[model samples]
Target: MSSSANNAVSSPFQLFDRTEWKRLNGHFSYHLSQDEVDNLHALNEPLNIKEIEDIYFPLAHLINIFIERTKDAHAVVNGFLNKHTQRLPFIIGIAGSVAVGKSTTARVLQKVLSMLPGKPRVDLVTTDGFLYPNKVLNERNILNRKGFPESYDTKLLLNFLSAMKSGVEEIQVPVYSHLEYDILENHMQDVVRPDILIVEGINVLQVNSSKGNIVFVSDYFDYSIYVDADEKDIMDWYVSRFESLRATSFQNPESYFHRYAGMDPQESLAMATNIWNEINRPNLQENILPTRYRADLILEKGSHHFVKQIKVRKI
Candidate 1:
């Protein structure tokens, strides 16, 4: 693409270096305890209190502003219609490639928002739970494509979101077990009404491509964030995380990856690389990364998993 074309493409967002982004943080300084920060940090994603103060605090504040604005708008609409509308949860969707540290971001956001003045009741659910059971994937001969968009029950996910937005007091959602590498059979968790609900996953931003429909899971989101990093950085993170999991989760006798726990380091590295090149990389390129443009904000990470830039979508 020409330089002008590239510039036009990038026009939708105003990029901020970490320093500039930090300036927007304002004087409101509330810090998370060490324990809270540790609990929210993901494996292989080293998160410190300083990082949260620098990146997440400002983000949480911005989201609260949007939430308040949404409430005001809803009230105006209700007044115009001369009817009281049921209040719905403010939904935030966090999307990114696997190993991009999106999970940590979701958890931290939930914790931070819950502490805000209104003390919103925040809950998080991952799209991983909506993935088809291993048995179903095996039957379809797509077990190897587990993290791909096609592996998810998109219709079921849509129904869940619809229920949430419809002001349903409670809904049962399936649970996924990472250790078992499958959806738990006959197991569901109840989600009660929440002031804020965060849905996090790689495919949360994916657009439906079949039947000429352009609808996306993100369409229901009041706000969306995409965690981004260079391909090489993500590849390294994925490999390192895989190795860490092999030593921990994979060590469980019932774990689906138990066999890999005893593999030689060289072999394990090779397997991780192969999986990245074959599964994760292709999915990121064709599905996940394309959706980044649709997000309200982008958290761009640099070396050592530190977020180096923030891209806020321009109105």
Candidate 2:
């Protein structure tokens, strides 16, 4: 390709620094108390009101714009058809490496979006629930690769998404337990006609090429965000979160990782590092990271876990 042609091939995303991104929250009047922000925070991720005001407030505003426009388009289509049709829920997908604070982002966004005018009902679901049960994973010999794309029941997930878009009044989603590290038997969460649904997970953006799947999980997303950070920083955050869980959740006798609870700090650190290197790191590099550019927006985090830059895909 010629140099001029290469130069003409612009990036799909329009980069915005923190200051510029913060300024995009035009006429946004909703506010979340510090206590609410604190409750939404995930372990090892520092979330404060200022961070919400700067990063997620603007993001919520942008998402509201998309939601409103989608509703308008639906009305227009119905008008053109001279018939009334139910509007499907707006599904937002949040994808990123493990310990990249994507869960916290999803929770915060759900809260912010719920507080928007008319008080829309926003529901959050994680792809972890769509993962094959531990028994199934063990039978398939992929128990150790739980977060990889192959670990999920893609057909079932796709069906669920399809149902949601078809305006199914009530949909039952299986629940996954972190403490048990397995799908809770017979337990389900009912999603009852939410105006908006946020699906968050490490594997949400992944495409199952090996399975030769034509439809992808991300195809259901009306908008998507990928939380991104330096690999070194993510590793450090993962280790830190592991250490925290060792002292808390892992100590529960019912916890799947209860064995790690008794380990000393140094031993816990070493174990966490080994798991990251052997499993999570490879999954991130091979599957998750490659899908980053597929998102409509990317939030890049600094070492302190604060979002330092935002990239919005050009319309």
On TM-score, the leading prediction is 2
lDDT of 1 at 175: 94
> Model 1: runs farther than 4 Å from truth?
1-10
Runs in model 2 with CA error above 4 Å?
A: 1-9
Q: For candidate 1, lDDT tens digit of each residue in 1-315?
A: 999889968799988988888789775468678998899988999999888888888898888889999999999999999999788999999999999999999999999889888688999999999999999999999999999988999888988998999989899998999889999999997789999999999999888586365556887899999999999999999999999988899999999999999988898899999999999999999989999989999999997899999999998
TM-score of 2: 0.97
Instruction: Indicate the TM-score of model 1.
Output: 0.96
Taken over the whole model, the C-alpha lDDT of each candidate is 0.91, 0.93
The positional error of residue 288 in candidate 2, measured at the CA in angstroms, is 0.2
Quote the positional error of residue 176 for candidate 2 in Å: 0.7
Worst 10 residues of 2 by lDDT: 4-13
- State the displacement of the C-alpha of residue 242, model 1, in Å, after optimal TM-score superposition: 1.1
Candidate 2 lDDT over 1-315, as tens digits, reads: 988667546778888998999998997766677788889999989998889889888998999999999999999999999989999999999999999999999999999899898899999999999999999999999999999888998898999999999889898999999999999998999999999999999988888878888989899999999999999999999999999999999999999999999999999999999999999999999999999999999999999999999989989
